[model samples]
Target: MTSVYPYLPEMIASFGVERKDVAKWAGATSAVFSVAQSLTAVPWGRASDKFGRKPIIMTGLFCTMCFFLAWGVSTSLKMAIIIRALQGACNGNVGIIRTMVAEMVQERELQPKAFSIMPLVWSVGSVFGPAFGGLFAKPAERFPGLFGNSYFFNKYPFALPNIIGGVVFLISLSTAMLFLKETLHSKRHSRDWGLILGRRITEAFKDRPFRRQQKLRRYSIQDAEASAPLLQTDGTSRPAKAGREKPVAPSMSSVFTRQTVISLVSYTFLALHSVAFDQVLPVFLNYPPQEHTPRNTSLPFFFSGGFGLNSGHIGTIFTFYGITSGVIQFVLFPPLCARFGVLRCFRVCVLVFPVIYFLLPFTVLVENATTRYAALLVLMICKAFAVIIGFPCSTILLTNSAASLSILGTLNGFATTFSALGRASGPALAGLAFTWGVKNNMIGAPWWILGFIAAVGSLPVWMIVEGEGPTAGSSDSSDAESTDAEEEAVVFDDDDDLLDNLTTARRGSGREQQGLLKKGSEDTRNTGYGTVR
Candidate 1:
């Protein structure tokens, strides 16, 4: 997916197509692709929630394989565009995959490791996808009989790679179908598309109160011990029959609190800047006609050859940045959050990123090749560090806020929707910004503008409270200590009374009372507040 555009020039030239026409086709196709892909996530997620994960995932993969095959066999540019749009619509696995991983992994501590592994796989895919595309995207003399006399082979030099991609997609689809187990526990599947889509949209808007009510009825009976059977006492008594009725626990509707909305907007802004810079930085750094030569010509060759960052050494450098950021997020950010708290960690990152952005322009001033490379490396490392600091903190803030709203999945969808919006627009915005800057002879202007934007974005985060010191509802400082002591005293008193009651019931031979106590403990455990000690 990442390398699709890299073959645009070759595609235009080989097909004898106008650059403008090709650009328009690509732009419209990509826009439709993005919209369809982004909008499909929630409904797919909802479908997985109802129809079982394996079936939904297998269906998606099968559709994806068909789309890839269509793309591989495309003869005309219009056909290619249609195939890509269908490909986007069918490839709604992002949200489903995340949900599956979450369901499969029980421990939160292991989540970062699982998430990290996916990106590593994707990075490998990204590197090889382009490398293989470039290798296979040559004239038919290179591989004469492989795709002999096919329209795709004649019109599109890159047809081989697409064909291979289609094969891979089919293999993946088959593998998933054979191995993947159902994760969703729902007894009833939602066959109605209208109802499914409506529910998804409603959930996105935090309107799950009616669903909660339906669930609550089932839980209310369970909570009231309606499942327990009545016992009859005759000579050699037997247990009585159970009630047919069960109380349902009411489902609570999630409210979009102000704090959650603010966090979402803030994250959207940050993502806009990050995605824009990610898309544009390589283009800016690798602009044609290299003005500066390295002191050691072998350095670029060595690194580029090893990493396969063919956009000069810049791509390799960015990969390093990505690797560093991922490592830090998995290793460092969690501990920092545990110590200083999520909000404090978030503010610190917000404060630091602007400083890194401000320093980026200085790379242009270093005249010595070694020094310049060193500076660029340091700048990239700092940017990576800022990302490490920012991303997890932002996630923590958003998740915590969502928890308060009691709608974690819907809130996450809202955040993702906005992030997708930013990603969709970021490249165009950067292109315009860069063109304007260059036209105005402001070679160094982008950095300052980025710095100012980052700083402004940070301001909203600071307005939100850092979770430390003597803030209300916090378990920090002497007040919290005193509160903890009181809580402990109450807990001890309750335990003592429970023990007394148990002892009295034993002495009185009242088994029903003991049974009630056991039921109460079980209920407490289910509520997630059970104390081990």
Candidate 2:
């Protein structure tokens, strides 16, 4: 995915697209991918909730493999666009993977360590993907000794890199299939692979006419116990008897408290501005320098223009940035987050974004290539670090803000959907801004605009009040469900109503919250309501 950005012009040109329209076409291609993500994210997340994370993840990887293979073979611009969109539509694994990480590692204090791996992986991929795309693309032309006159390479010039990408996904899929554990608590009890397979086969054959030919033995209570026996009160296992049954836990609802809503909105704003900046920065870095004119002679090449670099040079720079990002995320971020606390660190990082945005466009001032590259490496590292630090912090906040495990998938889905919308709009708008600024002899206008937007993105952070982070072994699922309900009720009830309710709750010796909790427990037991979570 990161590879696609640096090679946009080459890919666009292969379809006989004109040079002037390259920016527009590149923006459209990127936009369509996000559009597809926006449409499918929610449904994929919901499916994962119903089934399991591994299933959805594997499905996504399979689709991506197919998409990459198809992309390599595409003959037209429209085919490439369709392939990209298909990849996005089937690639809603981000949220589901986050959900898995959250579930697998529950302690809030340790969450930074766990979540840091995500950005590290991304950084590594971002570093190598561009290098591979830039160096190995159109292999028949680039590496004549190896691929010249080879029928496959001649016919599909970009096949080598794309095939390598597909193979990478294939390896990931195989590793996941072999080693990834199912983390869903609800499904944990029935996780015997044999039983699962048998159940699936039975279901598949139930409606077939051949199924009626054999006398099928009814599943006995002993079989149920053998498959998934109930847990004893003493943390041991025992077969469930007739009358006594454990009460089902409460499901998290879609309705969010004021804090969760504010945090989500803040995240959306930050993502919108950040993505736009990312899209514009790469394009600007590779653009040709503006010619000197009498009226525009005052504008330094550094302030209002770019350091003219080709695709390969730009990819190398990004590779360095990615390396720096990996070190920061792995070695730097966790301690900073632990020391300052997640919310405070998030605030500090977000506030620094505008500064990074403003400073990035000034790298053109250094005339020497080595000095210019060093300056950009430092500036870009700082910028990437800020975002890397804030992103996982924001995710932790979202997960902690969620009501319970039952609705975790839904919350992450919502977050991804909003992010997709932001990403979908960002590239096109930023590209348009860049195109317009360059046309009007105001090359720095886009940077100035992006910096201002980033500043605006920081505003919503103030609305999210911090709370105590979840601690290890403090509350199990049931207690968490009840406590989250109480907190949500106290925090989100209207201000006027809150005062009255608090007074009433005090008069009842704080029994009001208990009553609400009890009522919720009863609803869970009586109705077994399966939806809304």
**What overall lDDT goes with each candidate model?**
0.50, 0.67
Off by over 4 Å in 2: 1-4, 192-255, 291-295, 298-305, 468-476, 479-533
Evaluated against the true structure, the overall lDDT of model 2 is: 0.67
| Per-residue lDDT of model 1, residues 372-433, tens digit only | 67887787777666655665466545554533211333445456666555544544455455
Local error of candidate 2 at 102, Å? 1.2
- Segments in model 1 whose C-alpha atoms lie over 4 Å from true places: 1-33, 58-88, 91-93, 100-155, 159-182, 185-255, 290-342, 356-366, 403-409, 443-452, 463-533
lDDT of 1: 0.50
| Cα-based TM-score, every candidate | 0.57, 0.77
Q: What tens-digit string does per-residue lDDT give for candidate 2 at 1-533?
A: 54345656667767898654565667667777777887888888788776777788889989878987888787899998898788778876578888889887878778999988888898888788777776777788888998898999888877777888888898888777654666655454343454445444555667666545321212211123113444322223343332222223323444266677877887777777677766666677767765454656455532345666666776677777778888899889999988988889989988888887777666665567788778877877778888889889888887777656666676677777778777767777776777776666666666677778778878888777764432322234655356435333222111223234434544554665656434433332343111111
